[model samples]
Target: MEFSWLNWLYTAIAQVITWIHQAYSTFITPSSGLNWVLTIVTLTVLMRILIFPLFLKQMRSSKKMQELAPKVQELRKRYKDDKQRLNQEVMALYQGAGANPLGGCLPILAQFPIFISMFTVLNAIADPKRVSVFGMPADVVASAREAHIFSAGISDHFFSTQSVTSKIIIGFFVATSSLTTFLTVRQSVTRSIEQMPDNPMAQQQKILMYISPLFAFFSLNFPLGLILYWVTTNLWTLGQQHWYYSRHPMPKFDERGRLIPVEPKPGLLAKLRKSEPAPAEEPPPAKPEPKVVRNQPTRQPRSKRTGSKKS
Candidate 1:
């Protein structure tokens, strides 16, 4: 691939490392392995800090996307038969919420150029035959090549058949780097599951968990300086995420990836309702009948009967 466009990245990395080493040289040896190793670690921290805003945006976007998953699923069902239309609607939903399915990947993708450039620059530092146009002049290059973070050369690899002591030093960097990478990815995955188990990105994140740490172990043959940078980067990521998530906690989700709907809290009306029983309805009483009137015919009957007999 044509990476000429990435020359600027290499230059920036080289210059930063050069500046850091010069700054440290006031108190530390110019050729001290600790100086170069510390410079590399500092570079990782500086890069991460510069990109911290992007990291925050990426995280916020991921959260928003998860919250919008219900609507996204609705759109999918509505336009299941129309693939293109479904895509349009999904994107519309994302844009409406200022979220994107790929938003979480933006910061990572942005770092790729720097990552590649660091690899090249580290390799160049070990090779005296190469010339650098960046801040790394001949003398600086020589000092870096001769520097050692302990017994391991900044450019040495474990696979080069170096001595046992060198292997032990390189092995420490490799192990620390890989372990931190795993922890960082694991933290992300765990957070994702808690916040949005149904998030479409969660599955992709799981795959990255495996791929990221494995890639670290796979770099057993890579230069010690790059591995040192890797270790620092992971450490920064872990702390960065921990600090962010602590302040901006998200809602919990069920196993089905559904938000555990918060039960409405008791209010005045609800409290009164619980305290008082409902009034029971009653039926109206029936009306009474009037008394009947009767004549004194009872007494007249006897007398009338006598009179009629006489007539």
Candidate 2:
């Protein structure tokens, strides 16, 4: 059998979910839908915690770029005629800041594999008549099929299920998840305008901000378990971003789309300088000694002095 990396990832995620389910099932009912929902939530939390360093790096990269934007713009104007030099200078600035143009993308890139793996594993387990899937154990897959949240089967889809209760529960998750996604995008767009108002990419970011929520409607076709996982992850993202921004808020832009310079608090050195008494004014340096003028004897008339004149 070929060694499939994606399948391996799916198996790993499935195994973790199984372990979480087993732990939660100790006190909660082994077959309870609540236990399964809690299991998925716990799994999502763990994944987010594991990936937070990537998220932090991405955030730091973005912040560094934002801080360096004015300098980058200055460099562009200073070396507009020298493309090679400008590139060198920009690269130097990034290096000095320990920021990479690609760093902002790491979190997104890291999430794709995890997201796909979780989706695959859950979709497989959600199926009523599943064969071998992602190499996950048969018992684990079978156990998940019996789980339900709010009377809706864990595998039920909003459109596939006929029960109104199931639709409500699934719809609620879809709506909340989509709304959080939109809010996150919107927050990023606003910051982009402040950070790089003239950026052409801001328009595309705006388009995504408005349209992101629409993508959530596809949850109607996804398994309830997957949607639940998505909802938990989105909520986590929403909270994380909110907390970050609350502490390190992005600078605002003026109506003209210029970044507003924030006034920094005085540093320790500055405060000490301000608090210390002014140095005593030094006495003016003594003036240099006056030079004495020598008097020259007056000369007689030209005729009288002509005795020594040459012929």
Candidate 3:
């Protein structure tokens, strides 16, 4: 039987999830709900770690975009009346600077497939009737199907789960996930504005910031396990951005759209330099007298030379 590349990808992700699940099951508890949740969270961490290089690239691209904002605005103003020309020039500028306006989206877009696969795998595992795919063993699938969190099966959804406890838990996860997503997007937009107060993307970002939280309503139908994964990932993004910005802050801009130069916090080297006393200035050394060589040939007297010339 032939398998597509998508099957291969699913199998790979399934292996990871299975490994994490097994490890957690062994160390924590064979059937503990918390273990399964931890497995999901750990899976998220591992996924984030694996994509860290992409995240770094995204950060670099975002920084470039921020730096290019002023130039972009200049181009906007220069060709305000000629939209087509302005777009051409802007594209040229971005190309010249090697800046991709949408480069930061690559990482997020890349994760979508993995997220979907994971969700599929979890949903399949939750439903015993569903045939197992992605090279997952039937026994493992059966075991996963039985896994419960807070007396609620991991596959339980707000609409599908019959228990009030499961519904409440799922609701909590959905709410937190959506809230974090909103905050993360909002923070990103705010930073973008600070980097370029008049950034044209600001309005779009505003729309996203408000619309993002509404995803909780959509997530209501998703399995609890998937919700947990999403919430965990969103929280991770929140912390990651916070830590990243602390070290590499965006350029701050005022209401007038002028770049505000923030005073940099003292680094270790700066602190050390400040702590150490300045070295005392050394006095200038006295100039050494020119030594006359004792046996050096002397010039003949001018008068003797004149007499010799006369003779």
Candidate 4:
């Protein structure tokens, strides 16, 4: 029998879920609605943990970009009229700085397939009729089947079922997802503006920063689980960005790529001392003439007496 790669991947994921169910069953007492919620939360945490290295890489790349912004701006100004020159200069700048503008996005792009796979697995597990060898309760599975992974409404309510409570819950999830998306985008926009150059490119980036959040709002109708995943990711990104900014305030660089030192302001004592001139040292006292002058003085007095007698 030929072994299919897809089959192998699905089996591996199923085994993982089985292991999780076993651990929950052994340790957690009374697997109730809340327990299911906890299970989902734990699953989300595990997924996040798996992607943490990528998250760190994204953040470091972003910081490098921030650090390189000044030099990039200088290049932009130098090659304002030459698009080809600008591109070359930008690539050269990235090479010299050991930074890649696309590095920040690569991690996110890499996770896309994994995210899709996880979604498929979760959807499959939630189905009531799905074979369960991992001690997953039939009712729990049925409840999961009823649960809309993306929306707050029960999957059974696809067409006609109407409950005010369900509507309210759905509304809350939608609002929460939209609000979190907006805030995350806003925070990033603010940071970008602070780092942006005074060029057309900066203006374009600022515009996108404001516009992207509105686009994100449209995504609220996606699966509730997906929203939950996104909310967690956005919150993590926001916290990380804040921490990075606070701890490592972007250093100012000059046109020549040298970091400009921030001069320390003088204190009160230093200011007062600045106005006073330093004291000058006094010169040594002069030495007295030698006593050899006495011999010359006696000879002069004898010549004067002889001249008076002659007169």
lDDT of each structure?
0.80, 0.80, 0.79, 0.59
Question: Relative to the unseen true structure, what is the C-alpha lDDT of residue 280 in candidate 1, on a scale of 0 to 100?
Answer: 73
TM-score of each: 0.73, 0.73, 0.78, 0.66
Query: In candidate 4, how many Å is residue 95 off?
Result: 1.6
Candidate 2 residues 1-311, lDDT tens each?
Answer: 22465677777887788789888877988677998889888988998999999988878888888877877888888998998999899999999999887885777787777778776776676666776566656666666777788789887888888999989999998898898878877876787787787775788888889999999898788888888888888888878876676556665456554777665555557879999999999999999999998888888877668776654
Model 1 lDDT tens row, 1-311: 32677778788888888899899988999898888877888888888888988998988898787677667667877998998999888888889899876777877887777788888887777666776545577778888888987788888878873589989988888889888999999998888777666667788888998888777877687888888888888888898888777656675466565776554445556779988977776767767777777665555665576776533
Q: Comparing 3 and 4 by lDDT, which wins?
A: 3
CA displacement after TM-score superposition, residue 236 of candidate 4 (Å): 2.1
Question: What TM-score does candidate 2 reach?
Answer: 0.73
The residue pairs found clashing in candidate 4 are: 149-224, 150-223, 150-224
- lDDT for each residue of candidate 3 in 107-197, tens digit (9 for 90 to 100): 7997898788877777667665766657776656666667787777888878987888888878888888888889988888887778777
User: Least accurate stretch of 10 residues (summed lDDT) in model 2?
Assistant: 248-257
| Model 4, span 10-101: residue lDDT tens | 45554665466456756654234344445556665676678778767766767677777777877878988999999998888777877766
